[model samples]
Target: MHFKLPNKYLKYGYLLALVPIFFLVRYYQSHDPEVNTGESFFPSCIFHSLTGYHCPGCGSQRAIHDLLNGRILAALKHNLLFIILTVVLGIKGYYYISKAFFKREVVDWTYNKYFSITVFVLIICYWILRNIATPPFCHLAP
Candidate 1:
């Protein structure tokens, strides 16, 4: 199937809308660096609270905060999944933006079922490993 550009308003407007939200997230992460603390405005992960186990997205907020502050190692320590997914999404976003602006056809691996399954399996494994208290697994925790 050919990649068709949507209406101009919807196409560029969506990106324009995201600009403020992006800045808002950056500003919040900059001002409130203690997302892991109870006193912070960010809500605790409900899945983790209910199950007493780290969810796939646990520590993402803190990871975002660390990433915004240029603490790449700390961000990875908080949530490796977040880092990995961010990189993947960034690459995907680049392709999408290029397609929208430059009208270029690129090899988008996201359409492959194997890529989807791999990401799903990775998330499940990361979720389980982060909850395991064993030596190597313990390091995966937030």
Candidate 2:
């Protein structure tokens, strides 16, 4: 008997390939040491750099860096929301890959009205707390 991959399998394979690339980038960033301490190679967040204020995504890179370095507390300090969001996204990605490759089922994610409303409320709260709650709360900003 001969084996051949289905189109769906090929798509799953491509996605799985991204997993390694993701780790590679994480490893490089974690090991480099200089990426975080010095002026980052990427553009500075214009909002923070100029105004000393943070946007919602301000500390995401630092959070990821801390997580990659196995510093959970530090990561959370940088951006708890970013850490939570990354975990949620990672789980969703894993679910899709598993469905596509192993289960041979279509991936479907549905958020009920309550969940949607809760998420919306949480986002608004986070935004207001980060901007207005004072220094320590705003530390999560960036």
Candidate 3:
């Protein structure tokens, strides 16, 4: 039984869904998520709240908010890893969308063992660096 998804739906549907996301990011760019001011509605990091330490995603919300507002330096100050990952994932999305438009298989994203391992290691390193209290790594904390 070979049941395949219709190309017409997959292609246009993704583009339609992206419209709200585009507006959402733009809205965040202007409306201010207010992540750092202690007045933000966003939930606190459970890992941080319980362990009293920074987690890999501690400042990602603030980083995204800053990034959307074109504050590159401030975004990096909040969470460099999130910015990097955003760019990487954005490129991946571009690839998938292009393929979808051409009516190709969407699962064409190949998994590379080495690349996955490297990303995992980098994320772990960032998690550890953000927790360090020293001068060099201290800036990584949110």
Each model's lDDT: 0.85, 0.71, 0.81
- Segments in model 1 whose C-alpha atoms lie over 4 Å from true places: 1-6, 33-40
Runs of candidate 2 exceeding 4 Å displacement: 1-6, 9-13, 16-20, 31-40, 104-117, 133-139
> Per-residue lDDT of 73-105 in model 2, one digit per residue for the tens?
987877778887887688777787678667756
**TM-score on alpha carbons, each prediction:** 0.86, 0.68, 0.81
Look at candidate 1 and give me any clashing residue pairs.
none
Off by over 4 Å in 3: 1-3, 35-41, 102-110
lDDT (tens digit, per residue) of candidate 3 on 2-116: 9888978766787799899998777667655553566546677899989999998988887888987789999999888998989889878767766766656555343578878
Best by TM-score: 1
lDDT assessment of candidate 2: 0.71
Order of quality (lDDT): 1, 3, 2
Task: Write the number of the candidate with greater lDDT, choosing between 1 and 3.
Answer: 1
